[model samples]
Target: MRVLLLDNRDSFTRNLEHLLVAAAGADVTISAHPQAADVAAQRWDLVVISPGPGRPCDHPGYGPWIDGGTPLLGVCLGMQILNEHFGGTTEPLPGCVHGRAEPVEFLGRTLRVARYHSLHAATVGSGLEVLARTRSGIVMALRHTERPLLGFQFHPESFLTEDGGSLVHSALCLLGLR
Candidate 1:
């Protein structure tokens, strides 16, 4: 599979790239967060929005990609971006979470995922379904009801996440890439 991994100036992007390859056998291309127009000009089987600092509003220009019919996987801030693009709201968590591991029920299993975020989706967007959440009710995973779009609030590439590769494989399966 050909994947375009959009870098949001985050540190974990390289790890994500590696996981995409090892888990999904994807030919991944890393690009510093490109404009929607730039992304629209390319041919990609899948597009990955990497986790990054700041709120979704801080990093704009992803609407076209989200609505253009191409499959997309968003991580952390990227997931917030997806929510915001689809008319959801993002707000600060009561207490910011960073570099912590938490258990979430996903795909019929409890997965310990690494979370690093200060903000979260206050309301999910139209046509999107909540797939998983933390014990405290923080949204952990989501997918569009009709579109091939998925988002993860936690970092699957983080070493802290046990069976991280399986999460990547699960994402591909959800996106219909497997």
Candidate 2:
């Protein structure tokens, strides 16, 4: 299977590549271009759009990939992009959530996981499904109703969460990535 890891940061890009490759024997490729159009042009079975610290909707070029037919797996900032670009809203979320291992709530229960992000605003678009939620009422996971797009607010590469690796592995299974 083939996957594309798109990100401006080289370190995050490489780490994701390694994770997917190790998880499913996927042929992972990394792209450091900040231009969303360039990343959209590539053909990929799965696109792991890395979370950028900035607002992703600020770029008009990003629309194609998210709305286009690319099966995407969003992480962190990428999750925010999924919300913002698809008719959802993103404002400053209350409190800071930064740690490798933290107890977060989802569906009335706390799940120990790693959280690393500044923004947490969420509301799935018109037809999006929120697959998971955090104790703070933050949407932690989402999926497009008619496509293979998926989003997760946490970083699986961080050593904090107990099943960070498993979370990523589950993403691959959802997309039939292997």
Candidate 3:
């Protein structure tokens, strides 16, 4: 599958690229400073928004992708960007969570996944559906109601997380590429 991987210039982008290519045989293109117009000009089977170090609202390039029909996956700060662009709100965590496992309820199962984010989505817009949340009720995952967009606050590409491949595979499954 042809995939557009938006690199937010984070430490995890390369790892994500490697994992997607190996796990799903995706033809991935990495773009660090992605402009919305430049992104809209490309054709991709799937688009991945990688983790970054700051608030999603700080970036002006993410708003346009919300209306595009292409399947999109947002990881860490990318998830936050999706949330914020859809009229949701994000708040700083009481403490930074890195290299830790947290219980996230997904698809009727509680899975312990690696956590590496300090911001949590407090509320989502009407167009989005919450797919998972932490034990403390922090939004951990979300999907657009009528679109092929998905978001995960956790870093599924991190080797620290057990069964991280499952997350990657699930994304491909959502895109019907698995």
lDDT of each model, Cα atoms only? 0.91, 0.70, 0.82
Ranking by lDDT: 1, 3, 2
> What does candidate 2's lDDT look like per residue over 13-52, in tens digits?
5666777776668887777663556556667788777866
Selected candidate, larger TM-score, 2 vs 3? 3
Q: Sorted by TM-score, highest first, which candidate order results?
A: 1, 3, 2
Stretches of model 1 off by over 4 angstroms after superposition: 36-39
lDDT of model 3 at position 138: 80
Error of 3 at 6 (Å): 0.6
Q: Which ten residues in a row have the lowest lDDT in candidate 2?
A: 100-109
> Once superposed on the true structure, which residue ranges of model 3 sit more than 4 Å away at CA?
36-40, 176-178
List, residue by residue over 75-107, the lDDT tens digit for candidate 1.
Answer: 999899999888999999988999999889999
Q: Positional deviation of 114 in candidate 1, in angstroms?
A: 0.2
lDDT of 3 by residue, 1-178 (tens): 8888888879999989998888788899898766846756989988899998888866668666656777889998888888888888888888878889876767666667889988788789669998888778788889888778889898888877667777888777765666
Residue pairs of candidate 3 with colliding backbone atoms: none
Each model's Cα RMSD: 1.2, 2.8, 1.8
Alpha-carbon shift of residue 67 in model 3 (angstroms): 1.7
TM-scores, each model vs. reference: 0.96, 0.84, 0.91
Of the pair 2 and 3, which is ahead by lDDT?
3
